[model samples]
Target: MTRVHDMGGRFGDGAVVPEADGIPQLGDWQARALALTLAAGALGQWNIDVSRHARERLSPADYGRFSYFEKWIAALADLLVETGVLTEEDLSGQEGDAPHPLADRVLKAEAVAAVLARGGPSERPSNVASRFEVGQAVRTLRPAANRLVDGGHTRLPAYAAGARGRIVRKHGSHVLPDSNAHRLGEAPEPLYAVAFPASELWADPEAPGDEVVLDLWQSYLEPA
Candidate 1:
């Protein structure tokens, strides 16, 4: 029998232990289950709280249903306030037509567009090979299908699978690593693109003769 120590409800290899009564205690698996349930509940509450905040400060037209997975909502709202789209006074108070107080500011269309234009920090790749160049022939690299469940990682979608293309452009010096691999802390490698026939991307495509440009990284392509 393993001696189980209670570390004041914290569970880890070296958690602090609290004095336990003789009652049989739950194991690590049980504790994890409970934690996961609580975390889910907290995430739900967070969405509700943020949504309510949005409705108050934002104009009626600007308010809409928000996604729980949008962690950057607060930051966006803050930017809105900073840009004068909404104000602290607008968010203040919890009465009148609005039930929820505006927790933050609302973003104007121009402000939103500006922010959208500035893409996030570049995630670079680890290993890469400069196998192709502009005006050079190249082919898509068909890798094994990913088995893991998708969430935040990036992978080549099925739509572009087995498609042939040409190197039409190079997006100067970027760390184009596998999105999924990058999420797991892998470095981003250089990336490139090969233009595919529109017919390749879509069967019975209207632009069958036209070339569809793809911004593929180095790892996603090989010499044709």
Candidate 2:
């Protein structure tokens, strides 16, 4: 699971460059990529987290070279094939069976803004109490030496794995991506804003005094 995507704090990638170019706008392909991802979601085959994880699973070469929306389109294709909606051959120029779930309505461009503004909410009721609280010190659990997490779908980033941090705030119970990505279940767990000192994650952090905040779930943390 630990791969290039989690190599943010490591070498090779230089200082975080601010967007110095002019105002950005979606190009033709990027716009279509966004629409396709939304259309596939309307089919009810996979959740948002699953789509994101799929993008992360893209081959390192493609994942590194593809533009942002390209990654989304790639993930969309992966999911469509994964859910039996399409096949590799279908993607490879073959005629594919139509998905008729939302046959009557279409996600028109006119309504794209409204639809995206009303984001998919994942909050769920939890009977279980949180084991940690705001201001609590905790450590992210690392997989055993011989065992890497089976995939990159987990909420715990590889850079932050095994490091200690403090819970700055609790965002209440929400669907855990670790389970949601696998379609195992909602697996709602307490979410927190964990703030780690920059030096903890990198040998020579760009900004030594800054803190790297990550939205971590309960399952990823334990007593420091």
Candidate 3:
């Protein structure tokens, strides 16, 4: 089996480009069927009401990949439930109440398939400002009382918080769930990846003359 790393190169946009031959083989009909099934699962998991909505949001290429790896989807669903990202009730009609470990694993695979159908990790919406053009000055929002624990706060990384930066590019809009709690589902918000000079982020006497780009949500900014 070819390692995933051996399969593709990372594009400038952070997307992977699998080698042409690296793509697995599947008939058109089979691929379409898998896409349809995975779309259905996404609707159930995300509480999305319309099947068309799920399909419209997903990529045909990603859908085919999901079809090719059905087992992986089931495993992911199990993991999500085990980790409390989902509930047993979510898997109620899907599978039997077997041992938690086994049931969870099965559900994880199913849920993963749904996520793949929904465009995988990269496709989620964000909330960051696009109002600023390139080279525009912007101020980072101050950290709120409850900071994000999974790393640092959302929209504003600690180094950039309270710091000023230039908007290097516009990454468009995406869903901005409360990063601190990730509750309230998700809401559409503009997204931007601002560039901050390394010297600016760190008070280093001697550091590489490189800049760090942060994917900031719109809510994390005020006028500089």
lDDT of 1 at 169: 72
lDDT of 2 by residue, 72-101 (tens): 888888898999777788889987567655
**Cα lDDT tens digits for candidate 1, 85-192:** 446666574324543333333334455455446534554444555667788877775542232323212244546656777887766445333333323333456566
Q: Model 3: how far is 25 from its true place, Å?
A: 23
- Which residue segments of model 1 deviate by more than 4 Å? 1-127, 143-152, 177-182
Looking at candidate 2, what is the lDDT of residue 8? 51
- Descending-TM-score candidate ranking: 2, 3, 1
How far residue 96's Cα lies from its native spot in candidate 1, in Å, is 30
**Candidate 2: TM-score?**
0.85
TM-score of each: 0.41, 0.85, 0.46
> What TM-score, to 2 decimals, does candidate 1 have?
0.41
Which ranges in model 2 have alpha carbons more than 4 Å from their true place?
15-23, 96-114, 144-149, 206-208
Q: Best candidate per lDDT, number? A: 2
